[model samples]
Target chain A: MAILKTENLNYVYSQGTPFEKTAVRNVNLEIEKGEFVGIIGHTGSGKSTLIQHFNGLLRPSSGKIYLDGKDIWADKSQIRQVRFRVGLVFQYPEYQIFEETVYRDIAFGPKNMGLSEQETDRRVRATAQRVGIPESMLEKSPFELSGGEKRRVAIAGVMAMEPEVLILDEPTAGLDPKGRELILNQIKEYHKTMGCTVLLVSHSMEDVARYASRLLVMNRAEVFCFDSTAEVFKRSAEIEKIGLSVPQITRVFNILREKGIDIADDVYTVKYAKEKILEYLKSGGKLQ
Target chain B: MIKDITLGQYFPGNSVVHRMDARFKLVITMLFIVMLFIGSNTISLEVGFVFTAMAYLCSSIPVKLIAKSLKPILPILAFTTILNLFMITSGMPLFQWKFIAITDEAVETSVFMIVRILLLIAGTSLLTYTTSPVALTDAIERLLSPLKRFKLPVSELAMMMTIALRFIPTLIEETDKIMSAQKARGADMDGGKIKDKVKAVIPIIIPLFVSAVRRAGELATAMECRCYRGGEGRTRMRQLKSGAADYVSLGITIFFLAAVIFINAID
Candidate 1:
C-alpha cells in the first residue's frame, strides 16, 4: 500500500529568474505503509528539496503528489492537512522549538490538529516517552535544555501528532556518535512500536544501513534507485560513481573479496560482517 | 510570501550601463533626480519622461522589474495619491464635500507626483540592478575619500554598507528556513487574526535574532583569523577607473539637465 507518493514531480527554484535552478526534476516516488525508507544523497542532490514536496511545504512546479490515493495539490486550501498527515522534521529540527516549556513545545503539533487538551496532553507524554524525554524535564523551558535534549523535544513535537508517515531530514546531524546512536535507536523503536511509515533522509551510509529496511538513492535531481536495503547496497559501485559511498563495512568486505578472500559481497553492517566472518572461519573455508 | 523583495537587488548584465564606472553612475543618478525636479511644466515633464525612457532602454533592465519595485509600496502610493487629491486646492474644483475638495490642478499634481515617484524608484533601481554591491561600495568610498581629511572613516562606512548589502539575501534565506521549520510544526503564520499573526512571528523573530548574534560573533572571529586590521592600509584589487562610457553618460546627463532647465525657464 502506497501511503504517500509523487508522480512526475518537478521542482525548480527561482523559476523565470536568472538564478533559476531545477533542484528536483521529473521524479516519481512511492512510499509504502510501515516501511522504514532511507533516502540517501549527497548535499544539493535535491534530497531536501524533494522531501519538502512530500508534505506540501513546497509545491511542485509540475506533476502530482498523492497521499493515500488523494492528490495533495488537488485543493490548495486543504494542503495544510497533508502536512499533518505526513509530518516533516527538518535538518537541525531542534532550532524550531519556541514554547516556554518542553511540554508545550511537544504539544504544539497536536494542539494545532485541534485535538482536545486531554488528548494532546496524552499524546505529548506518550511521544516524549518514546523519544526518551524524561517526564520531569518536560516542565523546563526548551531553551534551558541541552542541545540533544532540545532535539528530542523538537522531534517529539511532531511525533505527538502521530502522523501516519514521519519524514526526518538528517535528524542526527551535528551530534556526538553516542547521541547519534541513541536517537537512531529511539527512532527505530518508534517505528516498531507505532508501525507507521518512516522516511529518514540522510547522507551518512552507516546510519541508514543500520536502521532503514529500504533505500531511495537520489543523484543529480533524479531517483537513482529505490529498492530494498540489501539490494541497493549491492550496487555499491554505481552508488560510488555518483559520489555517494556504501557502508564502510561493505567496502571492507568488497576489499576482502578483491584480495582473494571469499567473503560475502552482500554484507552491509559491522555486526552482520562480524557474524559472516565468524561463520566463514568456523566453516573451515568449504561452501557445503 | 516574503520573496517579492527586489529592492537593491543586483542582476548581473553586460550592458554599457552596467559596465560604466559606479561613481559616474551615482553622480548621474543624482543629476537625473535634480533634472526631474527642475522640469515644472508639461513640456519638460514629457522631456523628463523621454530622458528616463532612454536611460531604461540603455540599461536593458526588464520592464517587469519596475513593477516589482512598486508592488510592496502600493499602500504608500495610494496614500500619496489620496493625500494630494484633496489636501491641495488649486484651479477649479470638480468635487466638493465640506472642506474636502478635488480641483483639476490637484488632480494634475497627483498624477505628476505619482509618475515622479515611480520614475525616481525606477532610476535608483537601475543603479542597483546594473552595478554589483562591491562596485557600489568602492564607488561610495572613493567618492567620499576627500572626507578622510576630517577623520570620517570613509572606508569603514563603505565596508559596513558592503557587508550589510551582501548579507541581506543570506538573512532572508535564513528567515525562510526558520519559518519553514516552524511551519512544519504547524505554526499558523499566514491564516491568522492580526493578533495571532503577530504572535506567530515571535517564534521566527527570536531564533533569527539569536542566530544573527551568533553569526556576528563567528564573523568577527573569521575576520580576525584573516588578519583584518581595519581599513587604514587596505588596498583594493580592482581599482575604480572612469572609462569612455562614463564620460559619455555624464555628457548625456549634463545635456538632459540643461534641457530641463531651459524648458523650465521658457515656461
Candidate 2:
C-alpha cells in the first residue's frame, strides 16, 4: 500500500491578497512504503510547500493527502497524530534545537508522542548512538556542541520518534562535505535498518543519485517527472531546461555523448560514472 | 500566518503622496495627529476626518490594505471606547444602575474618541504606506541633523532604526520557518493546558533567539569586513530634496490645522 499519497494537491500562499501565489498545483504522487525517494527542484519550485502538507503543517488549498491509505485531514482533531507518524527535519535543523541537554532535545519528539519515560530514554540514547553522538556528549548543552553535532542532535530528535515516514528538506545544506556525508550516511543507514520511507529533499544531485531509488522533480509548482533515478536522468535536457541541472557526473556523460561517444548517458553519480568509464575502456572504447 | 502583519509595510506607487517629500509627510502627519487632539467639537473632528480621508485617497493604496493596517489596533480602539463610555459620568445619566451609569456625555465622548483614533491610525498609516522606510529614515536623520550641536547620536539612532526596520521581515520569516520545524516534531502549541501551552512555545522561542543572535553576529562581521565605520562619513545614494508638491501639501495641511483650531476657538 502507498504509505503516503497526494491527489491533485494545490496550495496557494497568501491567498486572496495582492501577494497571492500558487505554490503547489495539481501535484499527484504516491510514495510506496519503505521507498527512498529523492525530491529535487529549483528555488521557489514548491518543494518545501509540498513536504509541509505530508505532516499536516499546511492544509492543502485544494485536494487531499493520505497516509497509510487514510486521509490525513479527514478529522481536523487528528492532525496532530499525523505529525507523529510523519517526521520532518527542516533545513538548518540545528536551529530548531532548544532543550538544555542534547539528550532532552533528542527525547523531545518521543516525549510529545506520550512515550513512557523509560521508552523515551531508550529511544533517545539509541538514536544518538545511531547518529554518532557519544553518551558523554548527550548530557551536554546542545548549544555548546559544534555545528555538525548540533545538526545530528536535531536529526536525532526526529529519528527518535520512529516515524513511519521521515522527510528531510535539504538536510545537508550549509555543511562541509564531510559533515554532509556524515549526515547523509546516517540517514541512509536509518532507512536501511528501520525499513521506513525516506524522502530526501536536496539540491545536490550527486547525493540523491547515490542514495534514492527514485527521483521526483518539481518545476513551476508542478511535478515535472516522478521515475527511477536512471530514467529521470535519461531526460537530463528537459530537467536542465527547467532551471535545475543534473549531477556533475551526469553532465559529463551527456557531454561525452554529444561528442559522438557511443556510451550510455544515464550515469548520475561518481561511482556509477567510474564504473561506466572502466567498462568502456575494457571494451576498447568502441561499440561491439 | 505571521505574513499577515501589515505594520510598516510600504506599498510602491507613483501617487502624489508617494512623491511628497518624506520630511514634509512626517511633519504633516505629526500636525494631523496634533489636530486630532486639539479639535474639541463635532465640526472640528469632521474637518480632521475629511483631511485624513483626502490624504488616504491621495496615497492610492488599496482599501483592503488600509483596513489591514487598522486590524492590529482593534483591541486598543475597544479599550479606548470602553474607558470613555464608562468613566465619563459628569452629564445626565441615560442609563443608571448601582455605581454604573451610561451618561449622555459618556456616549458623546466615546464616539469622538473612536473617531479620533481611527483618523489617527488612517492618517499615520498613509505616511508609512506611501513612503519607503529608507526614505523615512533618511528624512529622520536629516531632520535631526541640527541636534548634532547638542552632541546627540542622531545618525547612530537613525542607523539603528534602519537596521531594525530591515530585519523585521527577516526575523518574521525565520520565526515562521522555526515554528513549522517545531510543529513537524509533534510539538502541540494549541489544544493544551495553560502551563503546557507555555511549555510548548519554548521549543520555538529558544531556536528563534539562537538564530537571531547568530544573525546579528554574522551581520556585524559582514559590516566590519566591508570597512563600515559609524555613520559619520557615509554618503547617501538618494538625497532628500523637497519638490513643489511637498510645499503645496505642507501648506494645505497647515491650513487645515489652522481652520480646525479656528473653528474650535469660535465654538
Per-model TM against the reference: 0.92, 0.96
- Lowest-scoring 10 consecutive residues by lDDT in candidate 2 chain A? A279-288
Which pairs of residues collide in candidate 2?
A: none
lDDT of 2 by residue, B1-267 (tens): 688888788889999999988999999999999999999999999999899889878888888887898899999999988998899989999998899999999999999888888888888988888999999999999999999899999999998899899999999999888888888888887877999989888888898898889989999999999888988889988988899999999999899999998998899
A91, model 1: CA deviation in Å? 0.8
User: A177-286 in candidate 2: lDDT tens per residue?
Assistant: 99999999999999999999999999998899999999999999999999999999999999989888888988988988888888888898888788998899898995
Candidate closest to the true structure, highest TM-score: 2
Locate the minimum summed-lDDT window of 10 residues in model 1 chain B.
Answer: B41-50
Candidate 2, position B89, lDDT: 83
- Tens digits of lDDT, candidate 1, B55-85: 8898889898888887777788899999999
Specify the poorest-scoring 10-residue window by lDDT in model 1 chain A. Answer: A279-288
Q: Write the per-residue lDDT of candidate 1 for residues A162-196, one digit (tens) a residue.
A: 88899999999998998898889988998999899
Going through the candidates in order, what is the number of backbone clashes in each?
0, 0
Chain A TM-scores, candidates in order: 0.96, 0.97
Alpha carbon lDDT of each predicted model: 0.88, 0.92
